[model samples]
Target: MDELVERVDAEDRVLGVVSRRDAVREGWLHRIGVVVCRDGQGRYLVHRRAEHLSRFPGHHELAVGGAVGVGESYEGAAARELSEEMGVRATVCLRFTFLNRSGLSPHWLAVCDALLPEAVAPDPREVAWHGWLTEPELRQALGQKTFTPDSREVFDRYLASRAAPATVRNRCP
Candidate 1:
C-alpha cells in the first residue's frame, strides 16, 4: 500500500497530504526521515537494501529511514524506522534537514541521529545485509560500492555538516 505523506512547500511548510506514489510520480516535495545509527563505539550501522525491494534494490544505505507519515514528526518517523528496520528502540534527534533532488523526486530529508547502545539484527525483508563501518571506512565504501543516489547525497551532506564551513544545519520540517 502506498503511504500517506505530508506534502510540503520549498521551505518545508506543510502544503497538504498526498499519497507517496503521487508524490514521487508528480515530483511533489515530501518528507523523509532517516536516522544515522551509531553504536556506542561510534560506528555507523550501514545496511544493504534487500534485493527484492523495488526501489534501489541491492544497494547499500548508510542509515535506517523511510517516509514521514502524514501528521508524523520527523523524529517520530526516524524512531519508527529505526525500530522497524533495525529492531532498536532508541531516541533519535534531528541533526539537519535538506532538500534532496538527486533522486527521482524532491524530498525534505530529515537526517537524524541515534546512538545505539548495541547492535541488533535488522529486518531481513528490508535489509539484505548490514555492518558497522567507521567514518573513514564508510567514505571509502561510498566510492567503492554502489549506493542509492539519495543516500550518497545524504552521507555527503552529513559529513559536510561536521567539517565544512556551511551546511543545512538545524532545518526542520
Candidate 2:
C-alpha cells in the first residue's frame, strides 16, 4: 500500500491535497494511531518506533499508527496502522477528539483507543518492540518524557475522559 499523507495549513485545516513523502518531509500531514489496552487480565500493546525513524526514533507509542493517506478516513488509517505495525487485524472504535500538535508543524492527529486479543506481531521496519504498560507505569513514563509529546497528549485526554462522570438519565419529566 502507498504511504499515508495529508495537506493542512498552519492552523491544521485540511487543504484537500495529499502526498505521502511530501507530508513527512514538509510536516504538513495528518496522522492517526490506535491505543490498545486490555481489561483486568493485564494485556495491552504499545510499539517502540524503529531507531531509523525520521521522527521520534526509539520512543514507545500506542499500537499501530501512521499518516492518513489520500481519500482515507481517520478510522481507516487507524485500522491500517494496526495491521501494518502490529500484524493484528480487528475492528476499531474511534473517538471524536483529535489530539493535534500544531506547534510542531502543520500536522494534525486523530487518535483512537481499542481492545484486542493477546496475539500480536510487530513490524521491524516501523516498530522495534511491543509491550504492555500498566496505568501507573504509563503515567510515570509520560511524566519522565518517555513518550512523544503527541502521544502524551493523547493518553492524557484518554485518561481524563475515562474519569469523567457519565450523564445521569432523566426519566418521566
Candidate 3:
C-alpha cells in the first residue's frame, strides 16, 4: 500500500497529508517516530536495514521507526513501528527531540526508549540483521558512519537526554 504521510511546514507545523513518494520527492517536512529498545543487560538493539529498502539500504539504525501516518499520533506511530519492525510490544514514552532537516528527507524526530527483556525478532523485509551493542560499541560505530543519518541524529539526542539532569528530563512538556 502507498503510505500517506503527515506533511509539515519548515517549522514542523502540520500542513496536511501527502503520499509518501511525493513527500520524499518534494522534500516535504514530515514526522518520524523512533523507539530505542534496550534489554535487561543494558545493551541497545540495533538493526541492519534490508538491502531492498528505498533509503539507506543495508545501513545500521539505532532505533525502530518510520514516518508518521496521516492522522496518527507520534506515540502511536512509535509503538506501531517498534512492533512492526522488531516484533516486540512496547510502551512508548515519547520525547520530542528535534527537527532534523538534513539529507533528502526532513522530519520532526521524536524519540523514546522502550525497555524489553525478551529477545527481538526483526522482520526480514525491514531488517537484514540485528545485534546488541554496548554504549562504547555504539559510539565507535557512530564514528565509522555505520548508522543511517536519522539513526545518528536519534542516537545523539538519546545521549544528550541521558546527560541531562534528572530534574530537567522529568519535567512535563
Candidate 4:
C-alpha cells in the first residue's frame, strides 16, 4: 500500500501535497497511529520498535502503532496495526488527538485505547521487545529516553484520560 501523505503549513494547515514516506523521511506532513492496551491489573503494554524501522528505530512505544493510510480512518489503521503487530485484536476507542508541527515531518496523531485479555505475541519484524508497565514506570521510561517523542505524548495523554475518575469508573463498572 502507498504510504499516506498530507500537505500542511508550519501550523499544520493543509497546503499542497506530498508522499507519506517523504513526509517521514523529509519531515513533511503525515499521520501517526497510537495504540494503548490495558491489562486486567490496570497496567499498560509497551514495546520497543524494531531497529530496522526507518525512523526512531529501537525506540520504546505503545504496544502497536503505524501510519494512517490514505482514506483510512485512524481507528481502522489502529485496529489493523494492532492485530498485525501484536496478534491481539481490539476495538479502538479514540481517547486523544494532537497536531505536532515542529518536527521535520509534522503529523496529526490519533491515540486510542483498548483492553486485552493477556500479553500479545509480538511480530519480530515490527517490535523488538515488549512488557507491561504501570503509569509510573511508563513515566520513568519517558524520562530515560526509552520512548520516542510521539510515543511519549501519546502515553501521557492516554494516562491522563484513563486516570480520570469518570473514565475509570465506567471501565470497571
Tens digit of per-residue lDDT, candidate 4, span 86-164: 9888887777667865334668777777888776898999889889888888778778866676666666666677667
The parts of candidate 1 lying over 4 Å away from their true place are 163-173
* lDDT tens readout by residue for model 3, 1-173: 78999898877788987888888888888888888888888889988999999888999888888888988877789899989988889788775567887646777887877887658888999999999999999888878856787777777778778678877665422
- Whole-structure CA lDDT of model 3: 0.82
How many clashes in each structure?
0, 0, 0, 3
Which of candidates 2 and 4 reaches a greater TM-score? 4
Model 3: how far residue 114 lies from native, Å:
0.7
Cα lDDT tens digits for candidate 2, 1-173: 44646576655567766556666567655655454555345545666789998778988875467667777777788888888877877766565445375334546665565667776777899888777777777777667745665766677666665555543211100
Model 3 residue pairs with clashes: none
User: Which residue pairs in model 4 clash with each other?
Assistant: 27-104, 27-105, 28-105
Instruction: Give the TM-score of each candidate.
Output: 0.91, 0.77, 0.91, 0.81
Clashes of 1: 0
Which residue pairs overlap in candidate 2's backbone?
A: none
- Candidate 1 lDDT tens digits, 70-144: 889999999998999888898887888888886669999988977887658689999999999998999899999
TM-score of 3: 0.91
Q: Which of the predicted structures, 2 or 4, would earn the higher lDDT when compared with the native?
A: 4
